[model samples]
Target: MEFVILTGLSGAGKTNALHAMEDSGYYCVDNLPPLLLETFYDLCDNSTDNRMKKVAVVADARSGEMFADIPEVISKLRLEGKQFKILFLDAKPNTLLVRFKGTRRKHPLIGEIASGSIEEAVELENELMNGVKAMADYVIDTTFMNPNELMERVTTLFSAGAHDTLLVTCVSFGYKYGLPPEADMVLDVRCLPNPFYIKELKPLTGLDEQVRNYICGFDVMGEFLDHLYAFIDYLISLYRNEGKSELVIGVGCTGGKHRSVTVARMLNTHLLENGQKSAIHHRDIWKA
Candidate 1:
């Protein structure tokens, strides 16, 4: 049986993640108590129904005092020879605050559990969840992700037979728009020639054939790409050996409209050709 423990902060989209898991054929239970986890696993493991083979449970801070028992429960499970993976969903405190304000939902720690403002509650929750986060097999930061993107991420990570290898995401962004906080590696491609200088290529993005051709036309681009590919190849092997489940590579140039997008696409192509699971996002492409 495959058991997945889904836990995270109050406004980190754990509910949406659970729904995504359910859609992906996982039998999901929400807000399950830590004390009952062992019994629940036994029921699923001993059940005659094959549909119960894949189980996902959401055990978050809402369970009050019972939540404190989760670490011990996990330890017991490990001792019993039951293997499970913990996926922790998280977002920046400001993002969580915005989501809470937008939805008008109360923070779980704002009531009898503790007394404070929303921001204070968020801070307290983070401190409380630190231990669980440290033990997480995967930590997903969803601060900048929309619902569809979050669903895609959850699907990619939980997809059958896809979790063995590390997933990579190459994001192209403008330096002016700030760096992607989730990036594990940031590569600056600003040293390359800027296509925005060319009158014809100025209006076209890296996705266009003309802009792509112009960007790759430089000899330095080729040499840089060769080294970048080799470095990424070496780095990913080390990350996989270190049990990293995902790697986010940020490729940034001046405006993200030209050079960075081009190199990001090149990296995406390299990963694809090597039979790796990767996704590319042009974060500031449409920004003026």
Candidate 2:
């Protein structure tokens, strides 16, 4: 189980960091009081779902006076051999001030600090957070970072293994058998030449080298693949940057036994070769 405690000054992008972690597959909680660290981990650990194991929680000045308990919880967790890392996000006072004013929201510590001024609140919270900041495994100064840049840095620090990869599932189905319900994108390769017309190729599925060769023999196949690959590549970049994790692409032909299977396999291979995780399923290969 990987645990990360995300803590920082308010208006310093803690919520943004938590959102990035969520997109990276972490089970995330926002504005958790410092004292609940252990209990939160306990609940996550007890859950049967593997997805629950990787957790990140935001614990910061938003907790009011209870935020001071951060260092104590850190010490306790360390003493108990509980594995976790702390990420502290911070920005310059001017940057933070601008952010707070731009957003037109009262600082979390506004009423708690003396004089009830947001400026004083920022300074006080900064002082209070110093203890946990000193204990942090990572401290990110997000003063000049845009949201995408911050997300990239946080993701890089905690990524298990290219964690945000868009998982691609390619399915080959015959038009006669109906479309795959799970498909997010569907392509019709029915326009492609059919290998089933050839006596030798007819007996072999797309898995056979001869059938693949026959399919590849046409000039149109190469052109079609080039265009489809380019189109999918662009679409994938858009989807991936937008935080989409899974894509089901259906390749269809008159019969799933040949062209559709070949096209889906080709697409899957293309994705895998490019370091993307992909799977191919010939849904109606045996329907013939």
Candidate 3:
């Protein structure tokens, strides 16, 4: 079983990391006592009905006296051949202070912080947590990163693949509505003849063959697809070498009712057929 032990300085984004791990399919436990570490693992292993579970434990100084035993326990666990990794989340002292002040929580190291001072408390905690931080296999700075950025990093590090491919997030939007701010590539399908204009095909979307043929009927359409395919291949090569986790591609038409939706669906299928890990979103489809 793959196990991850998560510990970090207070206000350094441990909770956020836990949330992200949960999203990435880790069975997460929050604020677990250090002494219970082996007991928990034993319970998991000894259960007759217990299935193989990927486990993550969020541990910190809040375990009070039990926190002192973690290092020895970790050492013992390693000697016994446990499969585990430790990720320590940390941030700048100033950043942690701001986060604490904004939330207004008592520092984990109770008597250390100067009375009514965020800066003093931050420095004191950093000194105390240094030993724990030193033992981490990976340390992440979360000062400027949002949840999505953190999650992307975790997924990229954990994904079962020999090569890291560019993650393309393709969203189909409508010009009448608004463009998705997150798209890395945007293709305008407004110039493609509107299948909505046709009385017979009005009710159907680009998922329909007739609408797809109509959109691809123009000579420019063929050229567009040819260049688009090449561009995607080039991007995959560029990003995999650079260790990029995800990419976003947006396909927009006038209403997102017909042509753009069709193209986005087709592109999604084409990418899959070419052996890419990809997903698609029709942003404005329900609106129309």
RMSD per candidate (Å) reads 2.4, 16.3, 9.8
* lDDT by residue (tens digit), candidate 3, 1-288: 657788978897888787777766677899899888888877666666424366779888787657777788888887997766777778777778888888989877666444856677677667656777767655666664566765665564444421334556566778887666556668887777788878888888777888888878878878878887888878877877765555667799988778788888878888888988776666667664
By summed lDDT, which 10 consecutive residues of candidate 1 come out lowest?
A: 156-165
RMSD of 3: 9.8
Tens digit of lDDT per residue, candidate 2, span 145-255? Answer: 678767866775566533336667777888997776557889999898899899978978888888889899999989999999999989989988876655678899887
Total backbone collisions for each predicted model: 0, 0, 5
Where model 1 places Cα greater than 4 Å from the true spot, the runs are 112-116
Best by TM-score: 1
TM-score of each: 0.88, 0.56, 0.53
Q: Write the per-residue lDDT of candidate 1 for residues 73-151, one digit (tens) a residue.
A: 8888989988678999989999999999999998888874445589988988898788888888777778767887787
Which prediction has more favorable TM-score, 1 or 3? 1
Candidate 1 local lDDT, residue 47: 98
Best by lDDT: 1
Q: Rate the local accuracy (lDDT) of all candidates.
A: 0.86, 0.83, 0.73
- Residue 112's lDDT within candidate 1 is 45
Displacement of residue 40 (Cα, Å) in model 3 is 1.1
Worst 10 residues of 3 by lDDT: 156-165
Order of quality (lDDT): 1, 2, 3
lDDT of 2: 0.83
Choose 1 or 2, whichever is better by TM-score.
1
